[model samples]
Target: MAADDLPDEVPADPALSASADPAPSIELLAGPLEIVDRITIASNATFVGRIGETEVVYKPIMGEQPLWDFPDGDLGHREAAAYLVSEAFGWDIVPRTWLRDGPLGVGMVQLWQDVDPAQDAVDIKPVAAVPGEGWRLVFEGYDDRDRPVALVHEDSAELRRMAVFDVVVNNADRKGGHILEMPGGHRHGIDHGLTFHEDHKLRTVLWGWAGEPLLPDELARIEAVRQDLDAALGETLTAYITVTELVALADRCEHLLQSAAFPHPRGRTPATPYPLF
Candidate 1:
């Protein structure tokens, strides 16, 4: 991928720099994807590649495992839908993601986030550690060695936005590793193939703000997304999620606006994804 091929400003989490994005829309999304390698940790056929100079993660529909709940070969659409919702909230919390035909088949391609290795939004610490002054505890348990440990995340407005984003999307998987800690403290969530189900399936390590009143800005974001649902946003997502799920997405936003608070974890499903990291 040649750096000089595109324009100046880029979209969310440009893999490299301004050279990667001047006008970031078309070339990146509609690309001749070259596969550098597979992202082995991902469950699906995931790869790292580029349209030009920009780096991206690609998940082919053909590689998705059958889910008892979701329709097959459409995980890419759900991921794109999640990106749309994140953009609607005016928070680039999901990174830039879109659907396109890739080297394998149709899939979701997203800009690779360059996370700061020194930062960890969510962490597990020894239960006896005392310096949790600004962190939120999700739960406590024992590690594999039968040692006591605590599941925790930083208590901050940035992470709070991500938590709200998860609730609105009914994100079924918000594992600790999914929360990418960007250089500037902006936490971006990925792997949304499990999102936007018609049913409530909010699972995460971010239960710290349960029942807390929503901040004014948080309410505004939710309200804005609600208003857009029946309009452009709804229309765009129709190509991705089912109509029922789209309506359910709207309903979730409205519920948040009406309650004006973060929700408590309540569901038959496990409240957190497995292999938390």
Candidate 2:
């Protein structure tokens, strides 16, 4: 729980700052579909589009539930934070998001990614009722001219390395369903609300590398982040997270740099955190 296990706070770059207009334009997949107003986001929120186009996941904003001690139905702030970090890290993961006014008033707009079509459909039956339930795995390939190969496999070495990345971020949710298998062997991660915790509550299903060693490049990245902790990037995270939480994030980076091997987290295995959608 010390303030030394997190990534440095990354600041927003002038070139990638949030848009000036708080409310952007809204559109529907079907022509002239009614834009339902003030809809609430509950468990029943359903996805209405494919990955390539706009996928609308509807949920009521009014609620008082708590997941991981964080307020429920606050997808807006979570979406914003995810966008900021995803952009800063230059990660190919996660969908691009923008704040906008929608049927539920002001909300977030995100790009939808499709499920991989190569691997056989994952049987979501096994982990359906776990604590943070409801997960499904995507396939590995799809036919097309522009698509590339999938980078990481669920049980591959690259994915094991990704598990380490998740640990450093204290990702509480990393269930099988959260990891996406794209058309080309590209693997992407989604839903990053529980990261940057004040306490080092690192939990994730990508624990395939729990006791492994970091690659030279990975270690280098960790060290570089340590130097940037108190700089621009760290400063940006402070805007969304508390100062203490920011410190905790930096602490994680430092700890990772000091250790030759990955450290085990204290708790039961962590599942993938749920996305607002």
Q: lDDT of each structure?
A: 0.82, 0.49
Per-model C-alpha RMSD: 5.3, 11.5
TM-score of 1: 0.90
* Residue 89 Cα positional deviation in candidate 1, in Å, after optimal superposition: 0.3
**lDDT of the structure predicted as candidate 2:** 0.49
Q: Provide the TM-score for each candidate, comma-separated.
A: 0.90, 0.63
Worst 10 residues of 1 by lDDT: 6-15
lDDT digits (tens) for residues 132-245 of candidate 2 = 222223323332554432212245544554565565566666555666677766666665655656665665555434556887867766666556657866665554556776
Output the worst ten-in-a-row residue range by lDDT, candidate 2. Answer: 1-10
Number of backbone collisions per candidate, in order? 4, 33
Q: Give the TM-score of candidate 2.
A: 0.63
